[model samples]
Target: MTSLPESPRPAPTRAAGAFEVRLSDSPLPEPDRRALIASPRFGTVFTDHMARCTWTAGGGWSDRRIEKYGPLNLNPAAAVLHYGQEIFEGLKAYRHADGSVWTFRPEANAARFARSAHRLALPQLSAEDFLGSIEALVRVDAAWVPSGEETSLYLRPFMYASEDFLGVRATQQAEYLVIASPVGPYFAGGVKPVSIWVAQDYHRSGAGGTGAAKCGGNYAASLLPQQEAQSKGCDQVCFLDASTNSLLEELGGMNVFIVGADGSVATPELSGTILEGVTRSSILRLLADSGHDVQERPIALAELRAGLADGSVTEVFACGTAAVITPIGRLAGADFDLAVADGAAGRVTTGLREALTDIQYGRAADPHGWMHRLL
Candidate 1:
């Protein structure tokens, strides 16, 4: 018997130009805003406005607008308050040397946001709306986009269950918002290698869980282990698979990669427990384009240990939205400690970081068309 053909994907809904603009009346003065942008913390300083929209089971998405940035009012019994039904996406808007603003692969972030909403029982927002919201906020607060070296406006788009019921069922109402913050380098010391603590006691995700989704609960669960890593004098924490605890999973907030001396690069495969990061995929593409043997497969902890001991694993690094790429300097556990090749940033790691950042800040050509112009 012949099998039926797969269904065609639905066309993305277009909601651009739907957000109504309501500029803030008491915006910060130019000098103050400039001072804040000069040396801004990662997520602390915010722009003057934010974009918002509401979703309902009956009415669907409505009331899209750009409003003043401030605290949100939620019911005490909101589903997200107790059930943790929420999702978020992070990306950046860069100011090119020619004074144009752009973002890197926002469509990828929008697709992932939809997948996360499906996983968390929240409403799936359209790609047009997602991009529209970001553009709306950035257009009103264009000055917030920093022009310094390695500085950009960090955009955070998030959705949450706004329904007041607490019956543990899917939310009937939801709210989506986009906020912007000017940020400098993710790491304060500027691209230095970092130490990691291998988490022997805690696991990030299991066989069937929300590990693949970008939600608040997953991050909430990692706080204790991260604190433990800090106590051990490490900058980050590495988690192993939950089933056997022998395979490498990921770091606390980023994906990990191992580079071999033989010009092979490998990272943990997407096993339904690892968050598919946009930066991670970009680096993988860069690696493949440069003719490196890129492998996405199960990386056994024992194998990594053996490779490091024998000098087969020449470099290690982590990638995420916040920290674009960070070299793994040392790996420490309860029983063992291993430094990655004299504890300095490796050649491959630095090269990939600069290559990717070049494409981001428009220093080099974007051959893959990953950069999206926002303004």
Candidate 2:
């Protein structure tokens, strides 16, 4: 990477923070860019520019700039490679019908990113800085935001130790970056009911672990269980609490919810052992606002299975950033298999999915002031 100009260049200013966005000398041709966005795959390609900033004890978060997307020449001894001291967040930019750009609940992602940074012993970047990076990056590559149905520009903002130290302590230097990718629908065939494998041999997070943080290690720990789930003819893995293995914690990558026949919605309460999903929180609020009795409490595995068996729990679904709402049709383990009514997406599940996506894709009113426009 080249050094910032001796004198700062003209920059865009945000209410909270501002940064200079330097255009790339060699940008992708418009034709190729259009063709790629026509049918893009997840995480397979990147935009022309990236937003970045570095932090140090003496210098603070200086040299804020949006530079060309390229490889990093990190030293072999970087602490992150060996010690894994990093945090990251995922959100998306959408193209509305009138050619404006927006994102859903970005402030929540910024808040969670700050919480993850604190948990990882990384520097605390203000919410303004976080939102600035996303807005700035999207503003630079505004064309990459796709306009097709269920298409978006995925934004991944991550920070890691830049210090080339082998010590096991938090490094004094770190680098924050935001990159973008054009992605089509997560499920090309449309949202369908999926089967889940109950993880009998593994736990996603332990007591007092990095469960609530959006760190890489937490996902690394889930890979094995996810692989096992895939091998067991299931679309995902349902993780139980590590201590008791009875109380439901979460799925491998999504928060879970169950709807009963009595117009009640219940999900596993936050116990510091599951991800605080933005989609999960929004769905809960939307359900409660629609006059449903929403409960956040410890949901036991036995309770879920018995409800399914008795036809009381009519619907089950998972939520995350990628696939907003995924219906769970069957729960399979070594000795038991429980299926929801008709093994199809239930009314409550479909209603919640529509309610959330309608707002996300600009089809419904955002009464909660969650959508933040970028362009």
Candidate 3:
């Protein structure tokens, strides 16, 4: 696994903008807004406000603001549209049962966001600054936070090159913005096993590519394969290492994990070509805490199939910020089909899911201090 270096402690907190709060006049209707917040779907409905900060090579970062959520009048020649210089992060603010809102390991997400920015050649935001931006916005939209089961205010922090140039290079001018959506469950129904299409023709990232970064291009490249998976009646697609095409890499939007018949857990190690999902890392820690001998190493495709055949692999699941944990029922390729046991959530899989959700919903003890109260 890829171990993160010692994280530098952030300085004292400060007001995000430090200047006068420039409020937006364009706000949503109160009653309609309440209905939307009551059952907001994933990424479909958004909060009324957003946080944005501008960056320039010469002027550094501008004072940020909680602006009205609206369309961006981007230049037709924006570099993000041409050069594809963009990166983003996905996290959530949960309303605990005690009526206080909190988030899990937001610092980890903030750190990963910086790493992703560095990889994309974009300016990095300080951990404190990043957290402050989100917190500031969440505080403003505190009433928009949903209290339904498995519901959260999904925060999407994105940076994109806003320079109005068509040159095929990273731009010096960029804009970072955080938009929030009150989202319900990722899957429409309750948690269920999903079939995955094993993609062999197209790869999400190759050797020495920008795979680790949660950039827009990587997801754009997977659209075709993802559509193909949908056509095949699969819920998602799994990608293997681009070089060897044998070792399991990750799914389209989540990381994969396998449980052994002997009750051990295993997941593909970070090979610099797969996203380091926050949910995936947390699950590893949770599994170990539950006394499962977790292994993070290269898991060969052939070995997984063989293990499944011999009943050694008990369960398979995929995890990410969107879907906390989704069990895999089968893997469909062009020729052969690999089916997991009965297309059901395994004992270990469901147990970990419940445990993580418990912490998220404020039902379980947070021994690791992962929950940071926002309200």
Candidate 4:
């Protein structure tokens, strides 16, 4: 018997103003909205609307709109529920002193989003659409952008398989959505040093795995390890390379760095097992520009421990979109626990955080043109 030809897959394309805005009739009152923005509990409160779009295997992307933020009606057998075909990106919009709103390295996030989509077997979203969705949502909910120090509207853009079949393959239907939340500092009070528990047993990702992808499953795998960290009186968890189990990979949700006593710096090289963090890359650039010797190579656990013991490793820190830069003050494992350089925020860590945030909040000159104005 003759088989029918396969359907032609649509190529990814860019379009301006792809997300049609639909204003919410029941928006939160100004007083209530301001109250929530004054003290947002980091990802708990949402804005008035969300940006959404749909994609099909044969028809490509369609039905783009910004609508009321509400529940989603998904079939019980949705592919994302079973196969875990999902990817997400996190970024923020900063309100400058002059009332202008901007985002840092959004194009980088867009590129990474596309990369993640490919890894998750999802349709690639054009950078233009990725950014347009964010801009549209933020424009409609510009009131949600907070102006306080270390406060901004956090943008979460995610894509998931929406198909209602369980054939154990990539879904034919998918959905992409962008939601905004006004958030305070990722760490509650202020930027302070955080203790970390080294995961001696669990690995975040392995070689030939979805380690490099910014997907939910990777974060899901780290929850237990994170819980263990909290139980051990640490704030976060660190994962080592699965193959060697000695090479420092990264923290649960952030990239890590080791600052040497000689003013040199090093971070684990992109080994396809660590998410390529936008904040991590920006910090590297800032460090390089400031004349510090920056190296990206495998940072072994033994090396870090020895350096810490001998006072060669002056500081350790982690970086991500939410926290920007967090100093790792202590590292504990099954057999050993140690403080990192007086268990305080190091000079390099503080300086890097200030420099990055300065640029982000428009306090310093953006020499690299990394800031993208959204409003």
Candidate 5:
């Protein structure tokens, strides 16, 4: 019953059901959506419509629709709340300079979402259907996309087990939904340097854990360390590899990068433990395109501190969908601390940030064809 045409690729032998778009008659008025867009805050407000698809073992996927946004009447024994079989993704829709709305590298997110679904034992949605769902939502809520500096509409697509029975395993029924929210500037005034606390006591995930997947439980595991960082007046938390306890891994929500004094940039390699962030991958491409030597390898904590102390490391930044790029000014640990480039944002950091945003907003030429126009 899906109105969106299917791709010519062969369907999976055990594919989930496709969804249908049910246009909302009571959609938000233009004036109201515009008013909300004028000063839209991040993740505070939602659009008028949301895309949903349900899955079951016997019937496969069915009852797909873009229904009105509201609370769901869930049973007390829903599997998601009890068993935590859920996964989600975060991406943005940028309103281009010419008033066109587009998303950056959504195919990456779709593929990651499918991987997360498989890891969680949930039904996997096809890449075509995933892209179509995002397109449908963005098209319906195009009015909610703001056109201010550093402003965008953040899209969150999530899937949760919805079976009423809870047996501590993967449920047969699952629900997938996509929601949009117009967001303001991530930084209030300007992009300032952030301090990161080393999470020495707690490890976010192990080697074989679901660390690479963008699942809810991984984030839930970091809340305590995040709070600890907040209490120490730091902005974010950085974790080391659980086994070695020395090599760099990633931050709570973003991937970390360091610029060496040798005019080279280095990021932690995606070793099945770090989240493969879209922004991180984009930065790698942008930096390489700009003729900067980029390396994805294992960097040790001692090396980072030594580089910072000797002025060999020029800049350090974190990248993700939400924060985009945040320069890490200082690294704090139990016994020592080091500041990169006098705790100031470096030239390379700002340049890469601008380049990525340029391609995102369509102000510069997208040589890589990373943007997909939705409206």
Candidate 6:
């Protein structure tokens, strides 16, 4: 199987050009919109508009538009339907007390989106273009940005092969889109320590596979394992490295972290087999800033299990866009269950979560300028 070289990309511009904006003729009634935002669910409900851009072999990326949110008209034999050439990203739009909307590390998301596109043989949406598309969509649906507590507008940017074909090859046509949902919290009970299930029977992705890419195929492969994890009463599944199945790679959708009694923190290093999480990177910086030794190295499952038995590792947690920081209260498998810090959210976990959320919600000073103002 041959791979397509990345097409020469155009210089990215801010989302300030004369972009087309077509408002919905029949948007959701204000009464319903207000009620919906009061207690919004995750990912199911969408805002009034979406941003779209198309890419073609000869034309590059063009035809950008912000139109009403609705179902797409995909061909019966679309390449994405068969070949699974697709990638996506997840981030949030936070509403501050001063009525400004901001997002954390959008440029990081854009850069990672481009990396995922490259790995999947799809056209790279410029960082400017990605940020601009997000800005455009959020601008039209500004009212949909939820407030109070940890509520925010969840943004999902995705791209997939749109060409109609039966045989497997590089994508000739693709579509990039941005849609948003008002969400309250990822874990229904909010940020707390949760249990983790160790997947001993399956591996997420192998060496030189799409494990590191934020693509649907990698997630699709983990569904069965995730089902198993849930059946075992675990909130999420922990996957080991595919090559050895001993070193900790990451949680199904989030990154894993461990803290030691020596006031040190560490997470699984990027081994080309795990998705590089934006939140995970931020936590490392914050940990170092808070006078904790931060380590980014391969973590062995045996060491983690032993650390729990001993007192080397005092806390364990998971980090991602949806669930900012969830402490792993328990690590359970078929044969054994290890209690983590008396099955409670630890000090390190809570402090890190607070620091990150503070920067996100404009409660604290953003020294890194990570928040990009969408409105």
Q: Which lDDT tens digits does candidate 5 get at residues 104-201? A: 99899999999999888899987876777787777667778888888899999999999999687789888889998999766564578999998888
Model 4 residue runs over 4 Å out of place are 1-16
Clashes of each: 0, 0, 0, 0, 3, 0
Candidate 3 per-residue lDDT over residues 63-136, each given as its tens digit: 78887889998999999988889999999998876567787899999999999999989999888778888888
Give Cα-based local distance difference scores for all models: 0.90, 0.87, 0.86, 0.91, 0.85, 0.88
- Which segments of candidate 5 are over 4 A away from where they belong? 1-19
**Number of clashing residue pairs, candidate 2:** 0
Query: Mind sharing the TM-score for model 3?
Result: 0.94
* Best-performing candidate as measured by lDDT: 4
Error of 6 at 263 (Å): 1.1
TM-score of each: 0.95, 0.94, 0.94, 0.95, 0.92, 0.95
Per-residue lDDT tens digits of candidate 6, residues 1-375? Answer: 122342332332356343478889989999999999998878878999999999999999888888999999999999999889999999999888777778899999999999999999999999888889988788789899988788899999999999998888898999999999999889888777888999988888889999889999888888898999999998889998877878998888999999998878889989888999999889988988889989999999999999999988899999999989888899998788998973475888888888999899988999988998877
lDDT of 1 by residue, 255-353 (tens): 999999898999999999999999999999999999999999999998988888899998999999899999999988898788898347688999999
Q: Residue 144 of candidate 1: its Cα lDDT? A: 93
Question: What's model 4's overall lDDT?
Answer: 0.91
TM-score of model 1 vs. true structure: 0.95
Off by over 4 Å in 3: 1-20
Candidate 6 TM-score over all chains jointly: 0.95
User: RMSD of candidate 4 to the true fold?
Assistant: 9.3
Residue 138 Cα positional deviation in candidate 5, in Å, after optimal superposition = 1.3
Q: What is residue 281's positional error in candidate 2, in angstroms?
A: 0.7
